[model samples]
Target chain A: MSTMAFLKRSPWILHYDASSCNGCDIEVLACLTPLYDVERFGIINTGNPKHADILMITGGINELNRAVVRNLYEQMPEPKVVVAIGICAATGGIFRECYNIAGGVDKIIPVDVYVPGCAARPEMIIDGVVTALSILEEKRAKMTGAAQIKDDARQAAGETT
Target chain B: MTVNEEQTTIGVALEDLTREVKALQTDGYRLVQIGCTDTGGAYEVNYSFDRGYQYRNLRLTVGPETEVPSISDIYWGAFVYENEMHDLFGIPVNGINIDFKGTFIKTAEKYPFSVTRRGGDQCRNA
Candidate 1:
């Protein structure tokens, strides 16, 4: 029995489009359709960052939205995994030639999983989320250990003060 | 007889664009979109507007050094277009109601749509 075994069972997701063309976005939505129903794995598409266990980003980060991406990432508590959902998110797709297009989601934030494709298929998106779940569980284990160490140090400091 | 839905293009001098846009605004026309194209060190600016059903365009050629007057006075909504023109095309614009200060189409690089390419001299923001 793992310390945070329940945490790995139901990991919520927060979907964001850095600045994509909506192609990958539709595919991500398709994963929620009856055909895919990623929810069977307990992956919930959430709108709130507080409830998000996985941050799924689907576009190249522009300078304007760079701050916005950082803000959402910072809001999500520790032990979270970030999944770059498509080619643009993994590496700014067609817009890479354009003057303003930045490189990838990892250029702005840390990415645990990278799904490759112009518009990644629904199955691949579901697969990426499944991979993200494992990463989230790993991070959660590390985070719990770090929190306990910090609490012990703080308690020691309190005894002296 | 019904009027064709085709858009008509009008070429005007940079000096006369303000006057033409003002007249069109007074005549109940709306400023649609402004498209800027860079060709051989010159900016080919196309200003589109629609009155009721028909759409008209005003075309003008200007150098990158010249500052174009903001059409937001005529149509407040034009501020967005004018701001985009300034941000992308590096077209100097004055007096916008709500200026994004060249943040409209936020790109990785600055003045991305400008005629001044990577080798040439960079613009003010660069």
Candidate 2:
């Protein structure tokens, strides 16, 4: 299913607050406000992981939220993009040395874009989401290309038979 | 706007913890917070209470392996902190109303805040 056209028009995003101090989460919400208007980029914030094409995560993964984060990532369909917002999600920030923190989101799942800030600014978060949109398109293109290659190989085998 | 906040700390024996907490409850003091500190060989547990503008802390210093009685019976909401103390500091809290049994704040290491960690490896050289 080549949903690249649809994804470009409206890519759904799921925002997960792993262990953030609400600083980054507030900034993410700010992006949605009229001042930033993140939705202008054809991005819609979603609640269900299954419906999400982009996983925007704030804060570093911890023991408790590790499994939850992994499960959410797995539930997202292929050609998904992960955006690690803020210093915490990128490098565990100040909580890296803390006992519970398991470090960046990339430790558990693959991250495509990283927005670096203590509490990432609204503009930065919007930029990260826009960057994730391009990555998501790239992943979709790869998925379709892989399918095309497999189909071509099958067709060649049939012709030989 | 500045307000005068009076604070006092009273050392309470482990055995008398329940009695003192119960007295504070009867006196209509609201349970403010429960905090634990890893003080070398011992764990200092402080239970703070607030009434009007006055704040009082019941401090209990017990051995690392000592079992601390749960104040949840009096404050009811104290189970949250009691479970945290048990999970984070390795302090065995007895008779908690809702006990998670060391699963409260799941950490990478068991009792990570404890001075003597379970494996005794993290801060040995630090």
Candidate 3:
């Protein structure tokens, strides 16, 4: 009914692949397939990070790509959610033994939801995204209150001056 | 030629398994690990399941210079692993993306560990 509710329900998402084996990357695309139909749930994959409400990351964070991944996370707008898909993103699966891999994605960004699997199943990824939306809604509510408090503080400061 | 009960586990020749892997249609066994240990100077290559869940480890022995058949056509993942082995051990896998000159070693020279006349003379001079 409300504009805020509509916006919260249909938040745009962006997919980022740090350096995956193409297994998890393909499974992420499977979620958007006609069989699963993630778009029906109001989850749209946006090309630009500025319009994204959630960042779905797939891959084990490596030393080389750590900075690039962090920069992308910073570029996203506030009240954003992060979803780490696949075992590599959650805990660095087979590549964990490799010296170059920097471990899990959470070490670089604040992960809201983690979908664990070598290459997370399509159904599970959809579930994780939906779960992230709920968390984002709660965060949005808190941020709205925080913004109102900041505005009130500014008004009071103007009067005192 | 005949199977012996006492030497069953110890000498169950890997040739039998390799034949089975080659016979497969869609999925095939792929060599995963290949390297030489400092203990006995023996080279070992371990082939495991390339596709499906149920698969067993198959071990094979070859000389340090012997060229092994490539399973890149069956399992695409083998390309990277084979390249890594070539970089570390200098073992060549035939039919592989041979352009994998060297990976982490950062050199285009032939087998760094191999002893040549120049290396021997340098050692003698030293």
Candidate 4:
């Protein structure tokens, strides 16, 4: 089913905190505040992974949470976008030196948008969400186009036979 | 919230950890946190117990094959820190109340902070 129209109006996000300090987490919350009000962009933050079109992850990947991150990413349906918010999620930041740190979110999963900051600013996070929405749209378009091409090829083969 | 206060330190062997921790518990001190610092051949594991403003730090210098007994029996909260020691330093901190085992860290390198890491490895022996 083409849920592209539904996804366009409401691209819900699942926020996952891997191993970051509260700095990046607080910034994410800031986006929900009246001042930032990210809902204007047709965005909503949801806890459930199944409901999320975008995955907003903050914090560096560690060994234990690597599987957790992967599971959440896999649970989200296709045409999903991953937004790695903060320096930690983008590159592991200072935590990279720590023995337990695996690295950035990209190390475990594909990331479409990266919002860089020690603790990413709310504005940057909003921008990242917008960017992710665009990427999600692009992916949906590509997916539908590929399906159309496949259907056309099957039809032509049946006609020839 | 920074304060300058005198902190007491007591050196205890790994075997004596459980007994000493029990004694501190008897004195009405709360188990704060256990810290493990890598010291090449050995690990200096510090257990910080507090009663009000005063702090008493119990330090244990343990090496490979030395199993630091978990004092989780005395302080139920000791498991978290002990599990950390188990995951990183490979100290084999046994009898943990909430055993995470090696599940504490999600890193590429196993026992990355452990002194048991092979000699002359790029990061180790540096």
Candidate achieving the largest TM-score? 2
Task: Give the per-residue lDDT digits (tens) of candidate 3, residues A23-94.
Answer: 988998888779987888777888899899999999888755788889989999888999999988988888
Task: Tell me which of candidates 1 and 2 scores higher on DockQ.
Answer: 2
The lowest-lDDT stretch of 10 consecutive residues in candidate 3 chain B is B117-126
User: Could you arrange the candidates by lDDT from highest to lowest?
Assistant: 2, 4, 1, 3
Clashes of each: 0, 0, 0, 5
TM-score per candidate for chain A alone = 0.88, 0.92, 0.92, 0.91
Task: Give the RMSD in angstroms, all C-alphas superposed, for model 3.
Answer: 10.6
DockQ-based ranking: 2, 1, 4, 3
Q: How does residue B54 of candidate 1 score in lDDT?
A: 90
Candidate 4 lDDT (Cα, whole model)? 0.84
Among these predicted structures, which one has the highest DockQ?
Answer: 2
lDDT of 1 at B125: 33
Which clashing pairs does model 2 show? Answer: none
Which residue pairs come into collision in candidate 4? A62-B106, A63-B106, A63-B107, A64-B105, A64-B106
TM-score of chain B of 4: 0.85
Q: Which ten residues in a row have the lowest lDDT in candidate 1 chain B?
A: B117-126
* Candidate 3 C-alpha lDDT tens digits along B1-126: 654322111211434543544654335544444333322344566665433334445566666555666666655666776666565456656766444555434322334443221111111101
Candidate 2 vs 3: which has more TM-score: 2
User: How does candidate 3 fare on TM-score?
Assistant: 0.57
